[model samples]
Target: MRIHLDTGRSGEKLAAEWLSQRGYTILACNWKYGRKEIDIIASLDNILHFIEVKTRRGHGFGMPEEQVTRKKLKNIKTAAEAYLETFPQWRRVQFDIVSIIYAPGGHNIQLLEDIS
Candidate 1:
């Protein structure tokens, strides 16, 4: 469990940095509403993004993005709604996923935008 948590945290950090390099301004990390959590909240080009970060050591089971099921998306949506209630200034919103596959030598990252 600790290893899983560590990997997830590392992945989120990488994702945040990657987004920053691409001109995304990060607003929050590990933002939660109830039991649901949005891994990262960022804005780019006037669009607010609620992002999910999925990290894995390898693809033994499958790609990291494949783990994001419909139920998970629903939960993210619910959390995003709660977030918007607090910060209603964001009229344009998008859902995204940052998938990371970490290895000893390197890591592969992919960003899936507008997932919702």
Candidate 2:
């Protein structure tokens, strides 16, 4: 099934809002490098966080977090390195994942943080 981009963007927005409420300050959204994209770059205190957001309409395929394979992690790491170069002041760097499972028949959003 092909996922619609508008729906995906809405999910990302919801995930960002949830993170912001948890004290995370968002630095970038949809930051890309070549073919890879980092959904959210955020900071909490002094730690710079490279975050990936995955969304699913249902659990038929798998949990959203399960989609982040090792290869995908590698891409995120590479893209993050490029991202950090822009902010040399940040010494602490970390990676995180936020899974958003939208309600099967509605707009409800559920979030899981730091899965990676």
Q: For each candidate, give its TM-score against the true structure.
A: 0.96, 0.85
lDDT of each structure? 0.95, 0.81
State which candidate has the highest lDDT. Answer: 1
Q: Runs in model 2 with CA error above 4 Å?
A: 104-116
Question: Per-residue lDDT for 1-116 in model 2, tens only?
Answer: 34667657877898899889989999999999889899999999899888887777777778878888999999998998888787788898888877777775664454544545
Show pairs that collide, candidate 2.
Answer: none
Task: Give candidate 1's error at residue 78 in angstroms.
Answer: 0.6
Per-residue accuracy of model 1 over 19-44 as CA lDDT, tens digit each: 99999999999998989999999999
Specify the poorest-scoring 10-residue window by lDDT in model 2.
107-116
